[model samples]
Target: MLNRRQLLQNGLLCGGAAALSQFPTGMAFADEATRLYWFGSPARAERTLAVVKLFETANPGIKINSEVGGNDYWSKLTTMIAGGNAPDIYQLAPSRFADYARRNATLPLDEFLGKIIRTDKLMPNALKLGSVDGKIAGIPLAINAFALLYDTAIFEQTGLKPPVETTTWDDFAKLCVELTKAIGKPNLWAVGNCARYSYALEAFLVQRGKRLYLDNGQIGFDIEDAKAWYGYWDSLSKAGGCVSAEIQALDKNQIDSNPMSKRNAAMTIAFSNQLVGYQQLAKNKIALTSLPILEGSGQSGLFYKASLHMAVANNVKNPELAAKFLDFFINDLEAGKALGVERGVPLNLAVRDVVAPTVDEVSKRSIDYISSIADRVGDFPPQVPIGASELEERVYRPIADKLGFGLLSVAEAAQELISQANRILKL
Candidate 1:
């Protein structure tokens, strides 16, 4: 493992003439490595490096210079782009994809698909999520949908029927209250308070025939929509159906910190693909199910999205080489085996099948769950508008936290969210 100084000394973290200067004159100048960067936990980074090694071994003479970023990834990436030194291949977040595309930071990949990159097995919705304004700006690495994941052991103990596809939010709340009462366990709640979760909020809004973003790049839903969404969890929390704010605050929403994984809650709202990781963290069996539908509204509002994407820089020095590496990273069976479902279910069906048999029972269940709901999911929503990430992580999350902590009324939280989101979106 290379430390920061070692990475800088090796030129992996440098660029251009400065980077060349870091290496021994002959060795570094000889190989024109296709630089790659991604931001993730250490585990995901290890899996990615394994795939990189596989790619290098399979295609001799083509070296890869890969770097993984930590907490400051987005800010650092912005700096790199501003300085005209972005990596040849990098991970693109769905929230920022359209923003990058509009800024010409990403190269259009329409020319590479089906030629350099295999597309026949890729899910159409995955490709759709990576595209902006009819141009394919990025290639999706995986596909995932929002879901309510619960502990089967807990449900059985309570003798409560677990939530299913057709379960309404009302029904879900009732079950939560009942589950908490029946369990009568200290510190354990029926469900985590997901009012602070942006994904859950999006799913709820979509069920009401509204979404986080409209086609025109404005905040889509209004105060009433947000009010109803928050009110659902708030009312449930008051009735002992959901964990209190203090308990919920212990979870930062990552797999390791999630309430369900911590045994502080029985159920949680998370992506379908996360079941593999969540199950590994839990002592008992965890299962995935559709998020409860809005009562009296026939809309499922479930959507399949690219969990993340791989994009080439618009100014890449070796476009063909970058495409070849991305093709191997995304479509190769060996890469699939190395990555498993860490990134989400593979977007490439053939690779998914190749990887499926190699994964554990929990991962296999994740693959099966995604397949079961794939046909019913709505189309990928509009490209997340610029500033939507800020709206979600910065504005929406804090406001939701405040609501959960009982620092703000439902109407107050709703108003704050809309006003802040609109201001960020410049609407």
Candidate 2:
């Protein structure tokens, strides 16, 4: 029997051979099709398989094998790379990109740009996130931005108009308070407080014209920015715009789930990809609006962040073939239409336009809305520094908990967070 590594490599080798026999071009067949290992949830696995099938059909000579695991993806990937068995294509997170790039775990695609791929057509900010140290380490699979999702029926019932394009954060806060009081239930919240969600906090900061990270990967803003952000939400909670601490602590998922779905909250900040789930949960129409700008900010202040789902490893034997397959997967119109935004909003410009006409009503609306505001969206911050992801979870989450629980004033929490984040980044 073959050893584990030999068996795995052999399977890939044979699969590549079988794949090559189906294509006519000898040059294409000369290279072996590459294997991809992904660490994603089971739901994503199912959607990804459909996309892969489409890719295989388009390029019959390319064989792509995917391994799906919900947990231990990073650890498993780390072990595989250590053993020289890393997959050609894999998943990468923004926070982990620098770590991989520093250790030479990923290939830089700068030389291959325009030769094998034209990134010019993609949303400029999305295309930029793939570059690390002036080289492209990976391609963005999707673009996700925060949007305010509201229950249309709740607004109608409360005699409150939906948030308009020109609505300010102050207007939104007043609306939240009015909506909560009209509902007259301690169980109901006007706005779902996801202060623990870093993206939501980041959106608030951005709306205030603050960058989340500096050029050198340092904490970009002073502690006062953080305080202003937390203070807004903390005040909103005090004004009954958010759920009480006891309820928030009992069920964390409620912020994005049934509470909003069942009309317990009038509005919540969520990603473009989550609209589908919200629609299903909402008995009435669910509408999405851009995040409100801060009063007098003058800047729209929203930023586009890459969903950075998949990446290819450098140690794989068939780098060129893997890159080709990725190109097809992201750029193919038919494949994208079939995949929809299951992975997130498609990053490929052509593919997005092609898929837009065929998607569901809600998805179409989302695409249109994002397209209208594309020019206003800024690029994501640089790949987060090592331990940055942990800082968000350990330090930031606890600080948010303290503020939500009324244990720490916004000023105190902001100071602690900045000090802790600076210390972690310094390390």
Candidate 3:
């Protein structure tokens, strides 16, 4: 009986031999095909499809059958893996990298890194993000840092100073209040309820020298930290700094639905790469700024994370072709120009340098913002544990919604959240 890794290797060699035999160089085989899967907005799908078309034109022998845009992407991927039909190449999030890599669902690309996939120009942190146990399971296509995106027009009109790198969370809340009062609009708000987001919560924890999960896969922060986090958001919500619960409930929690994007709020906490898409949706001029920090914290807790990784399945029939596509996607100047920052800043520094000048002002700012944070941001935290996503979607967001609606007090919400996280993380 072969183990999973051995089986994977066997599949690769046998599949490659069979594929190559059927479709020798000069002519394309009618049945040669591979699948690519990903989930994102229409803009992301458009940009990705554009690049896929380029890849196809360049590699006519290989055909890519693509699928995009589904709310149940992870669930569908899990089903595909179980059925031995995972996409040959897919977009993998850092949060789920450990889960797929540990299960041997993803291909290890160590053999191809320098030989097939170019990495000399790739950012070191971006490389680290796709690795687990020293094996490269994915190639980070782009990088993103946490940021506060605000409408510059709103700030200018209100005569308010936008958030700076040094601005504390306390100061951020006050600014929200000031902005809300100055605007004096019933429907419009200063900011969204950021506490309802896992990234925002993680940022808060990291600023205080705690992490969402420790290296050992246990819950990192204690009850006190949880209380402080929820309490802060609850206070902000009540103080009219954040959108009301009704308005927040209507939000679908994506780039298009975000308060700032909808023009219902002046600010939002979002990934640095999202500025481009957000700017397209928002009427006001969208600009990126540093996330509010914990006062006198040990570190800024801001770190560059792979927005998403391009991963090849371990059981892919055409591993070599997938590797080639990965190389082109990461290093090709034309692909980079087409992608812009919709997928976050390019992880390949050489590509970024060339692409930055050619992109829109919003995208250029995003690239510059990422560059400006090199010295201040901390190291990327550990690969989010197996149950981390569940904790965010199942435990964290629901509890945050309850707190926002005043169904649960801050103490109650914190206690419930911590207890659920501990149980889920097996701490």
Candidate 4:
């Protein structure tokens, strides 16, 4: 009779517990063995369960108790940690990791890196994404960057050439307008979306050689930067190159509701891993392209965002075993082959090479997409400031929604965002 929130808070879901009972390793492991609870989204269950089975076969003493928490994972994890019952090892988003690290709820992985973690096998940027305050705080499983995913059919029908390496943001916006007018469908937006919260805006700053927040715990970019970024998207929104606020609300921004999925949008901006999910929903062939850049932009604002991380909780009973399991998860070839970039492409270079041949055509496209702009990518962003999470979900997005809805002018929205973000971070 327990609801999802209650089940998640207790580290067990009703049907979820039943589902895990069916995993090959679920029931047989001894109680005395090391148990690690993994918090992951339900959408990630199938691939994660597959990886767990392989890990169990190779290492019998470690019993991984996995739960598919869906969107409740983070909220429940926060509650558990506050109540002194954090999961032994759980998946964390890079954006939220800092808040956890700042609170000392996450354990540092420095000692385990040399002994168990294969430091030489990971990209420096990949390694840094998991670090907070100079301490390696998590074991990264996969990395990705936002990309332009275009529907081949939509482009062909509209007679617009497919996107490529040199496509600038201006070119992309133009294409959006061209496709929308050519198709003559009011609902068919050119870009799936042109407005989003700080994550999307942060990409703009990165493109302009700025960060969202400086390491000294202050707002990273200027009012002009915010103005410019907001203005560009607002222009697209006003021109109908992007979906209107009402259409976005109707679609709820789900992949199924995206114009790209319905052959309505010629292109959409999304994380590389999302290409697979979008492909699953859309009948047309979906392909990945590098995010559009600014003219003369030296290196891109792009960095390999950690798709997910496995962090040992500070109160974990067996840190050694947790670290060993993490090392095995990342470094083992079989595990990599089993995962096959489902988690956002493997962060481990060795694993990438090992899993390369096994990927489906879509995954090969993603691998190629990441490699195409490899040299253009810039530095890892600093850890999110303490008030940053609130700034994103609460302050930033509401202001962005206002801009998209035409409720606020560019100057007004941009200033409000700058002032609010600065005040939040300064605290």
Among all candidates shown, the one with the greatest TM-score? 1
What does candidate 4's lDDT look like per residue over 266-343, in tens digits?
Answer: 677778888878888777888887777787444466877887778888977778877877887888888888778667
- Candidate 4: count the clashes: 0
User: What's the C-alpha lDDT at position 416 in model 1?
Assistant: 91
lDDT of 2 by residue, 1-427 (tens): 1223542454432232222111121222235466666654434554566667777776776666655544567887787788777767888877687768767898887766666665666766566778777778888788777788888877888888888656788988898889899878767878776666666777777666676676677777788888877888898889988876665554444334435765556677777767877786777888888777776545566666666646667765666677777776687777687678755688888888888888889777677767777777765666666777778668876787789998999989899989888888888
lDDT per residue (tens digit) for residues 232-321 in model 1:
888999999988888887876688898888888999999987887788788889988889997745677788888898989998888888
For 138-214, candidate 3 gives per-residue lDDT tens digits of 98889999988988998888898999888898999999988999999888889998777888888889888889888
* lDDT for each candidate structure: 0.83, 0.70, 0.81, 0.73
Error of 3 at 198 (Å): 1.2
Q: Candidate 2: worst 10 consecutive residues by lDDT?
A: 17-26
Determine the C-alpha RMSD for candidate 3 after optimal superposition of all C-alphas.
7.7
lDDT (Cα) of model 4: 0.73
lDDT of 1: 0.83
| Model with the higher lDDT, candidate 1 or 2 | 1
Instruction: TM-score for candidate 2, please give it.
Output: 0.86
Model 2, residue 287: C-alpha shift (Å): 1.2
Off by over 4 Å in 2: 1-33, 39-43, 250-264
